[model samples]
Target: MAAANDLRRGMAIKYNGNAAIVLEVHHRTPGNLRAFVQAIIRYINTGKSADVRFGSTDKVELVDIERKQLEFSYKDHNGYHFMDPETYDTVTLQENLIGEGRDYLVENLSVQVLYAEGKPVQIEMPASVNLKVVESAEGLRGDTASNVTKPAKLETGKTI
Candidate 1:
């Protein structure tokens, strides 16, 4: 158990008998009122999010979370496939779990997968990825504007 005041983003906790991941946390002290902790958590089972409040001194049950580094293998009709570097085993994740991170996925890319209660919960990608621009319009002559932009398609089928 841990105090509500010690809560931090990305921490997992058991709330109302459900395992949830803390997405955001804020400590607030309203005028003439006791201080409280405000947090936004997403339930692992239902994938639903809720805003909760707890007294500053309240105890919260912490859940164990594990992170594993996996390398991207490929994506087919079955789903996205990843391989564990140490075990040489393949793990397939559904499309819903991949989310927008699919835009940055490439062959042999390393990513972090978060597991809660021995189940995959989230995928963490690097802050930036190097991708090849497969399609883009040619720039016009003297179009060196500082803020100029154009539509481009990445190798992973994401348009930016």
Candidate 2:
């Protein structure tokens, strides 16, 4: 257990009997009352978000989360599949859980998946990822100085 004041974004904690990841946190002190910590949390199971408040000194249950470095194998009708490097085991995750992270996934790309209670809950991506461009339009001759950009399709079928 830890104080609510210590909560930080990306930290998983048990809130209201359910496990949730802290998305945002704010410390506020009202002019007339005691200070409290306000946080925006996303529930892991349902993918729902909620705002919660806690006293500065309130105790919050911290959950132990496991993170694994897995490689992106492929996507199929079932879902996105990732392979454990060491065990060579594969796990398919639902589409909803992959969320926007799918935009950066490519074959053999390494990513960290967080698990709670032996269930995959969150995916942690690196600061940057290199993706192969499958399709791109020819650059305009004089557009270099104007910061022009063009649409591109990646090998994973994601357009940017």
Candidate 3:
């Protein structure tokens, strides 16, 4: 059990009966009442997260999350693929879970994939990735005049 006041950044705890990380915590003290807690939480299991509040003395359970570094291999009809750099183990993640981050992911990019009880929980992509601009337009010498940016295609047949 953990005291509400003991919460810290990155600490995982039960929130609304779901595993969550303590993103932020706020303490509230009124004129004549006991202090309360308000926290922003990110759900651990499903990635569906929200903000919630609790009493200053509220007791909660903590959960530990394990992460592994995996190299992105490729994608096919079976979903996105990743391989553990250490054991050469492979895991596939859903596309919906990847979302807009997919646009920045590149082949062989290293990402941290989280798991709980041997079940894949989340895939954390790197802050940046390098991809070949497959269909970039001919760079006009005067194109640098403005701050405007144009869309470019990647070697993977994706456009940004």
Candidate 4:
């Protein structure tokens, strides 16, 4: 258990009977009123976000979360797969769980996965990834006047 004032971004807590991660937190004190903490939390199960307020002294249930670096193996009918390099074990995650990071996934790419109570909760992609262009279009002649850009397909089937 922890006080509401101690809540910080990326901290996992049990809220509303579900495991939620703190997305944002702000401590506010209104004129002639006591200080309170306002937070935005994202639920791990439903992938829904909510705004909640709590008194500064309120008690909150903190969850134990673990983060691991795993390598992207492949995706198939089961789901997106990642391998633990140390143990050579693979874990398959669903497409929804991968979220926007799927666009950046490539073979042997390193990614961080967050687990709560031994269950995977979230995936964190690196700040940036470099991918090889598999297909691209030829630039038209005299089309470089403005900041023009062309779409290119990466080896992972993502277009940019």
How many steric overlaps are in each model, in order?
0, 0, 0, 0
In model 1, the Cα lDDT at residue 43 comes to 91
lDDT of each residue in 35-107, candidate 1, tens digit only: 9999999899998889999999999999999999999999999999999999999999887667679889999
The model with the greatest lDDT is 1
| Candidate 3 backbone overlaps, count | 0
Better of 1 and 3 by lDDT: 1
Task: Give the least accurate 10-residue stretch of model 3, judged by summed lDDT.
Answer: 114-123
TM-scores for the candidates: 0.81, 0.81, 0.64, 0.75
Ranking by TM-score: 1, 2, 4, 3
Give the least accurate 10-residue stretch of model 2, judged by summed lDDT: 95-104
In model 4, the runs with Cα more than 4 Å from the true position are 1-9, 22-59
Per-residue lDDT for 1-160 in model 4, tens only? 9999999987899998999988789999999999999999988888788999999999999999999999999999999999999999999998866878998899999999988878787788999999889999999999988987999999888888
lDDT of each: 0.92, 0.89, 0.77, 0.91
- lDDT per residue (tens digit) for residues 30-120 in model 2: 9999999999998888888999999998999999989999999999899999999999999999876676888888889888998876888
Query: Global lDDT for candidate 2?
Result: 0.89
Candidates in descending lDDT order: 1, 4, 2, 3
